[model samples]
Target: MLQDNFGRRFYYLRLSITDVCNFRCNYCLPDGYECDHDRDFLSLAEIKRLAAGFASMGTEKIRITGGEPALRKDLPDIIQACKQTNGIKTVAITSNGFKLAEHLPTWVDSGLDALNVSIDSFDPRQFQAITGKDKLDEILSGIDNGLSSGFTNIKINTVLMREYNAHDINSFFNYVKDKPVSLRFIELMQTGDNKDFYQQQHVSGQHIKNQLLANGWLPTIRHKAAGPAEVYAHPDYQGTIGLIMPYAKDFCDTCNRLRVSSLGKLHLCLFADEGLSLKEQLQIDDPLPLQRRIMSLLNDKQATHFLNEGFTGATKHLSMLGG
Candidate 1:
């Protein structure tokens, strides 16, 4: 396993299968954004080889992401290939869940370990306003289908902005309380298309916690030993609720993963401008240098993202970062 300066073990690698998406979510990928790198996107075979390379270097968990991973045609093939890799223990995916109703079961058969579905609001109109799409019913139905298909450890990711969805936090928790899925409330970060929306939407983990307390929640961590999300199980609630505060409180200190863009560039930090490209070397008739380059860049993982640096404007959308 790869260990950083602070001894945080690196094992997870988020692989973006494609940068193309279906929705124009305001905070994620907006409609007017002109930069598209579909031509530079990695082929299925290349992605498989990259996964094998990462697995060879002691990475065990690989989460297949995309602008909307479901938008990719042959996603199951990639999942199967990653799962077959000896060192990789988990193969997962993160999607908006718009197309999940159709392809989720196929993904399970393809060996997906878990899933994180992005659902901003339960209100149909509000969801449309947030996602720039009117598929709230489809998204919810997709979650139900996944659950019915025996996906027990599912998680719903909801970004709680100050005015946008803060009022709906308790509603979201209440709705998912009876389900066998974990609900994650992510604090809005100022990045990508969210840069403009950041000032108006910035809400802290403290704000979410305070709301839970007001709702008569004596919440405690669902697992004494959990990952970055400060997960809590309500006293009489069925499922757990989690808080991800990347902006208010950085978890970069214990960050143990890196992102490989669909175009084969490795980003050490989410906000970093530089990326190590492996596409060229992977195409050539050489493997040793490519592997060395990967490990060398991994060793140089940033201690923390400069979210506090007052970085403004949506320079790179979340899709560009393999969200």
Candidate 2:
């Protein structure tokens, strides 16, 4: 297995198929926010080539991400291409769930192992306010479609903000309590040029934990999967609620993930701005040299991020890098 300097085994790769998104979420991609690397976007063929080469080096789990991966025209084709690679055990996608229902069967047939949908609030108005759109009904319908899509696993990602959706925590839990889905609460991270927005609405993992305690939730240890969230299953409820406390509790000490942007730049940390390029190498007929370069980068991976006090750092957008 290819391991990083932290001794963390590098097995999971979150690949962004596209940087463009349909909706303008407030926390992640705010209004009038244009992505920096739009001009350098990679083609479908190049994405497949890099994925195939990465699998050969030891990547076992792959998740297709985007500003909205569903916005990509040939998403199913891209999913199929990723699965066609060797050494990849699990293949999933993170989507805004906009047009998921229309492509349900095709998504299933494309070898999709799991799906994580971004749903912030249960209230329609709040949803609109948060996502900067009024398509809550479409998203809800997509969830129903996703459940009926026969996916092996389904996860709901909710970014917890201080006064915005924090009070609705109980309601959010009540909404999905008996359902067969895992609800994940993500702490907002300060990334990109939106430092002011993040600071204004930042909520830590402890804040979420305290809220759960207020509602009589007893803390319990959870299984650490490849995903960043630290999950906790409700004892009485059928479904689980996870807390991705990236700002509160650091998971970088055991970080084992590597990400590739839609433009073919490899990101070592989720919060890191600069990334290593693989576009040129992927264009070559042989990908062995490209694979060796990836291996070398993995060997030089840092143990932790520099988030709180410059001690640990993760650089990349949560949306672009796959939450």
Candidate 3:
């Protein structure tokens, strides 16, 4: 098992397969930004090798993230490879749900364990304004298709921003009242390409909770999950509501995960500029070296992130860091 100096056991890994996204979310990516086609992403063979190494070192969950993971033509193959890796218990993906509808059946067959879709707003204009795309209908269709495809653990990720989609909390809850999926509201973080926008529009999770409470929603104690979201459910509602408050509340003490970019850099913290490069190490035939490198990096994991201290780090965009 990989245990940091702080005694936190690391079992989860968020692997960014690619940084290429189709939509330009206002906060995540700048408008008119194009992904560099020349960038070298990790090959399927390399990802499989890394997954096996991580699994051998006590990592149980692997969540595939990207600018948009579905954009990768071989995503199903990637998921299947990770799922088949020994010691890896669950394989999942976090996406913008742009192409989920078209790929749901194939992914389900690929041993996908869970799905988290980013849906900022339901209103057409607000959705376009936030994501710089007019595909709200397509995204909604994709989510419905996911539900119909029997994905029980599907989650809707919404970033709460003041004067933006914060007022749509009740609407979001109402929209998914009968669905089995969980709605998770995430507090806007200081990272990403548009830090200025985040600073201007960031909303507190407490404010969202207050809005839900005012609307007769009751909170419930829920079991802790691999992610940071705090879950809550209404007495009469069918779906549960969750809040991920990275800024409003400190979750670093209980953090137990690591991230690896597409280029094979082991990120100890989401907001940290430093990381251990695994690109060259992965090329070696021996797996022991990669395993030791992972252990060494975990030992050096930051006890707490400095996002609260106004340290956004060098890798600011979510596209580069993965969602």
List model 2 lDDT by residue over 1-323, tens digit each.
66776677778888987777777788777763466654566777887788788788678888989878887778888888888887788888888888767775688799888888889888899888888888878877877876765563888888888767977788878866777788888887777555777778887767667767776665556322377666666678767778887655547866767889877888887766467888779897587888788887766566566677532134434566664
- Alpha-carbon RMSD, candidate 1: 2.7
TM-score of 2: 0.90
Candidate 1, residue 143: how far the Cα is off, in Å: 1.2
**Candidate 1: clashing pairs of residues:** none
Q: Estimate every model's Cα lDDT from 0 to 1.
A: 0.77, 0.75, 0.83
Q: Judge candidate 2 at residue 61 and give its lDDT.
A: 84
Q: Give the winner by TM-score.
A: 3
Tell me the tens digit of each residue's lDDT in model 3 across 64-142: 9987888889999999999999998889899888766788889989999999988899898999998888888998888
**Model 2, runs deviating above 4 Å:** 33-38, 210-225, 310-320
Please identify model 1 stretches exceeding 4 Å from their true place. Answer: 210-227, 284-287, 312-315
Native-vs-model 1 lDDT? 0.77
C-alpha RMSD of each candidate structure in angstroms? 2.7, 2.7, 2.0
lDDT of 1 by residue, 24-128 (tens): 777776673355545577887787778878777778889888877887788899899899988888888888887778888899899989888888889999888
